[model samples]
Target: MAVTDLNPSDNDQSFRCTGALTIGRAGSTQRELDAMPDGMTIDLAGVDRMDTVGAWLIHRTQRDRGAHIVGESAAVKALLEQVAAADHPVQVRPDLRPAPTRALAELGTWTVEVGQTLFGLLGFFGATLVGFGNVIRRPKRFRMNAVVSSFDAVGVRALGIIGLMSFLIGVVIGQQGAVQLQQFGAEVYTINLIGRLTVRELGPLMTAIMVAGRSGSAFAAQIGTMKITEEIDAMRTIGVSPVEALVVPRMLATVLMMPLLSFFSMLTAIIGGGVFCWVSLKITPATYAMRISEVVPLHDLDVGLIKSLVFGFIIALGGCFQGMLVEGNSEEVGRRTTNAVVQSIFMVIVLDAVFAVFFSSIGWL
Candidate 1:
């Protein structure tokens, strides 16, 4: 074992090494001395035993700092040569790359799986349509308790959130309308604008969104759990159609409650808009009511009720489809539940847009 300090120039800079450069102790020493000034080299000839680590340190030091190793013994040089080879191993090309046909085949398989899932959804909807006949023939067999529970879950539990959201929406609509009407000295008309918009569009749309988040996800998770736990299969074995026992009841519940929820939402939003008009627009409640009476027709409220009924069906159908598709385990239940909510909400929005276009084209607006 030996140690040396080499100075490259008159500057206060040098390299130092101590003891034999073996694999066990070389790593720490290399790290310590690797940060020296340029052109400093540590001699290694006195090193008696050397291994891969010692060789790697020398190789790295030379590569990084342009340092040269001097006075290396045969054993040290042999080890250094092996480390250099290992550090910079020769690259070898594969005998053959993946063929274009193979890539295409893999892509085709993935596309087919996606297509199958979509077709499965279509099949489920078709089956439910057919199952409706069965439900009608034996209506007494349907679980009324479960249906009422689903109704309460979708409608009653959602009232607070829907009411608060509708009120805020109403306030925004009133403020926006008031700004434009105030410019024309017709600020009282803000109530008409807010009422018509809320009853004809926003009320049903907002209520559907609330139910999509609340009841839609619950339906998917409940049915998905049943599927995973073999409860769906048990129901089938006991002469109960899963569609009627689970899905039909939920769908009916949603359809029954959606219009009621929409009506409640419309009332709240109208009240909220009136409040905003009274405070900010300096319009009295009586004047606002008179304006709303003159502008908003009964048909606008009817359109909202019809849209809520349609949106409710869509939400429940989406949720039930995803739930019936759930397989494998608990994770599948969660995955399908999330899919149910997203798909239901998207469907609700798309249908709302379609309704808007249809109604506008028919001069309903």
Candidate 2:
């Protein structure tokens, strides 16, 4: 095939092609076309094996000036059709709203379902206690290892974090109190404020929050994973009650550890408070000790310990309950673990409030 150029005038230029415009040859053709005058027509009658790039160049030339193709080949026509189609825009509509009333109704239904589930859990706990009592009478099918493992996990593992947090809390309380009391020339009384607050409220509350974040989430994830794998069912098939094997031991461990952990936290917080007082307020250790001794009563310590124990029980129970409810899926395990931490923290705060109200009403505060 031959390539020929026809100049209709000094300005009117056109090119005639008579060969395949393959990818390799298209680049040379493009350079030749580029050298032509701006308004030029290219005829593709003799061209063969037209591709997307050649079609695009033709379309672009037609857009810039004009082109006349004498050949009506199906491939060329199809490529031109595609280029024409590409120039049009597509419209899309997006749906952004979900039905609000339907969502509210579903939420209400879920709340009722959760309430019923809690009721069933309480019933199950009662029955497990009865079964435990009967089993104790005969002493059969009991695993000591599980109990010991749980105790170590929930108790020993939680001690360090609880101690550290409590100490920091004490320092914060002491520093804050010292700042306020310094205005009244009562900087020495900061120690009294720290001791009283730590022993009565902050100690138990902080300890409980720490445990919820640490051990409570651990319990939920462990049990929830077991549930997902149907290990709880396997345990039941082997004549082992899941509650006896799992929940009871955890509950016992938490109940025993919480008060002890709270005590450690309280001590650390007081030590922190002491350091803050000595450094910030320039109060002597003797004066701080005397103030603490005068302000903190034995009953206040008792109340805090009691609150810690209660918070521990709540945390353990919430963790186990959420874990047991896990529905044998990865998402469910994650959801339940989150639920355990949130529920445990909420319960701890609510119980703390209740205790505060009771103590205040009875003149303990």
Candidate 3:
């Protein structure tokens, strides 16, 4: 590349660039052009060829020094105009909202999402109720095979873990209670504590938690996978309700098995506590049995079974709701499964609190 400066008189100058002012031809006219006398006009008519770099240089010199282009080709002129328009830097403004305003905006958004989720869950529950009514009217449509499969999956397959967990919990509770009571020469009260708590609270609470984590998560995963594969859609198109076919069986199985599991959990826990007492406190097994019978109220067992039934319903509802919410993909299956378990466990605890308050107020304790 080459640039030649012209001066015919003092305080008047013009520059001419020539011979292919293009990148990779070994030179640029940028420095020579920028170093020219102030207000020097540039002539590009002599240039053999031009590229983006040459156009940008010409555009920049013209923009800064008011250089007059003499005989630039139309293509070069258009390129210069485009480069000039795009070269200016953009400025970004920082956020200026007050802290309280931003916080309130986030809170409002969260409230809206929560409302939508609750509304969706309600719709699913209503659909399930409709399906239930239809099945009641047409008993032949009820799927006993699916119900039995769900029972085997969630109830029979889950007993070992549930029983082990409750028994260990009872042992820990009895041992700790015995130590504390022994300090007051009241070790006999350990039996009372274990019997009442296991019968009225721990039995249902622990069993429900186990069921939620196991069955509820599975429900979300199963339905979510089916949804991703479009099986649910096929059912809908064929005039078969997916809820009736998939959800009802699981719900019925849960309702049927939860109370039975809770009852078994209660018995195992009582035995665990009794064994611990017999070993650690030198209390005979016969005496522990007598103490359990004397201390545990029949109403406590009734309350626990009732709570288990409600907990089963809530767990099934949570699982089905989240499963149906899955719109697409395997990632959503895992996400909805996690949400189902967490939501089921949360609802279980909340219901337990409500029951405690209700039973207390009604003098059922």
lDDT of 3: 0.89
Residues 1-365 of candidate 3: C-alpha lDDT, one tens digit per residue: 56666676775678887778787543447667756876787888888788888787777777788888887888778888888888986758866789999999999998998899888888888999999999999999899999999999889998999889989989998999999999999998999999999999999999999999999999988998889999999999999889889999999999889999999899999989988988888889999998888888889999999999999999999998898889857899999999999989998999999999999999997
Model 1: per-residue Cα lDDT over 1-365, one tens digit each: 33445444655443545456676786567666655765666677566666677777778877777777887888878877887777864659755547997789889998997688668878887888777777678777668898888877888888899999999999999999988988999877777789899999899999998999899999999999999899999998988889888888899999999999999999899989999988987788898888888888998998999999999998899899899988898999899999889888888888899988998899887
lDDT of 2 by residue, 138-227 (tens): 666566687789778877877777778878888889878877888999877777889988989898898899889888999899999999
Best by lDDT: 3
lDDT score at residue 313, model 3, on the 0-100 scale: 93
RMSD of each: 10.7, 9.5, 5.5
**Candidate 3 backbone overlaps, count:** 0
Off by over 4 Å in 3: 1-102
Candidate 2 yields a Cα-based lDDT of 0.82
User: Which residue pairs clash in candidate 3?
Assistant: none
TM-score of each: 0.68, 0.69, 0.78
Query: Which candidate, 1 or 2, has the higher TM-score?
Result: 2
Best by TM-score: 3
Give the alpha-carbon lDDT of every model. Answer: 0.84, 0.82, 0.89
Taking all chains together, the TM-score of candidate 1 against the true structure is 0.68
Best first by lDDT, ranked: 3, 1, 2
